[model samples]
Target: MAAVRAGWRRGRIELRQSFTNRPELFSHFLWPVLMLVALFFLRHRDFGSTGLLLGTFALPGILGMNAAMGMVSMSQQLTADREDGTLLRAKATPNGMLGYLVGKVVSVAGGLLADLAILLIPALLIVDNLALGSFGGWFTLLWVLALGMVATLPIGAVLGSVFTTARSQGLLQLPVLGLIAISGVFYPITALPDWLEWIGQVFPIYWMGLGMRSALLPDSTVVVEIGDSWRHLETVGVLGVWAVAGLLVAPVVLRRMARRESGSKVAERRERALRRVA
Candidate 1:
């Protein structure tokens, strides 16, 4: 209980710092601004014969994509912390690693919400046909967001533990982008080939996007989904599986990574970085 409270407080402090820090603050705005620009251009375009504006079709999917990207953020931060000896420091102190992990979850989740709002608010104005005014809409949104985080964030921690360097983390982006392309974020998954659709469905991204669309899009939008149904049961089943698996595996991976950390390793990593710079 004490550790959890300390972790929560640490996370809040870090989150506050991120907003105050100039470079981090700029990063927070950059992607949302770019997305808004894309949505602005797409606002008037119709999606096939459905008569729904392309922007409206894409908005909720973008939100899901953003939510899923929390994994990437978690991975990157973990790798950076390892490089800089933050993880080492945590490992040295009693219950410190637990606190660190808690802080990270709080900060990352909070940041994701802020980023979503940054895009969603402007998006609401740009796009029409959303059903967010309903209590059911808000309720679905909450659960999907919560479940999506649980499904993705631990997998991210595992990935971060696997890749020990900032440079190595760069390699993660290509596969992620590929996943996004197939995940139906910017377009309907039904429009893709059967194999591609199956592949997309295997990952959390597709379900996240589907969940968001289910929450926000009108009932008529079901035509573009598989079987012309929301498949809420399937969404819950898949994301729940992921959430359980990630929770089980993440601690093992993180503990292993933590075990390998030492002052010597941190010094060696810094030296390698300095040499690369030189």
Candidate 2:
């Protein structure tokens, strides 16, 4: 409990510093805000239809997109920590790995939540007459989407554990690109070929898109059919089996990656660097 509290304090300090440093760049979040405005002018009447489709369903989709962004960012930094012996130094501290991880999560979650806010402003401002009849469902949607995003945290940690360098995780580029392509993120899932549908089923984005759509839009038969039939489940059931799968697997993957790190391994990396410089 004390460790978590200390982690929280450290995490908040980092979060504050980040906000202070990036205030201007963060203000550019208005891009999404402007996008929603532009969309409103172009598709005001279609609020219940296309605009909502893009804005509402896509809100969670965009949030999920941040998961990929967050995971990659975390992985890159974590790899650097391992290479520089930062992880080893932290582990030796009384504060421990748990504090370090919790601090990281707190920091990452703040950035993600900010990104989510920017993504949402467009949907809410532009799409007037938003049926929002399912306000109750929306409450559930927020948590489900949050859970889905949280599920990706482990992916970032696992990636950090396995790859010694961000460059070493080069293989991730292929799947990450492929995930956005098939996950119906910027485009529609139905547009893809039959064989390709099978491919996207493996990742969290596909499920996040479905779950997000179910939360934002009505349970109509328009967009999804190939998967667990999110429309049929009602409310919380919208997330389906895949979201559950991510939550379950992420922690296990993280533990495995964490175990692979040892003081000797980190020290060896430092030794190589010193030899190279000398």
Per-residue accuracy of model 2 over 1-278 as CA lDDT, tens digit each? 87788778777877777777767356537555655565555543333444353444445455456555666666666777778776666666675666766677677777667766776655666554433567765765576667655656556766677777545766665667667778775545666897777676556666666665555556553445454366434323433444466446644654455567687877787787778779
Q: Over the stretch 158-258, how does candidate 1's per-residue lDDT look in tens digits?
A: 88998979999888878887898899977889889999999999999999989899998999988888999989899999999999999888877777789
For residue 107, give model 1's deviation from the true position in Å: 0.7
Write down the lDDT that model 1 would get.
0.90
TM-scores, all models, native as reference: 0.96, 0.71
Model 2 lDDT on a 0 to 1 scale: 0.62
* Distance from true location, Cα of 116 in model 2, Å: 0.7
Between which residue pairs do clashes occur in model 2? Answer: none
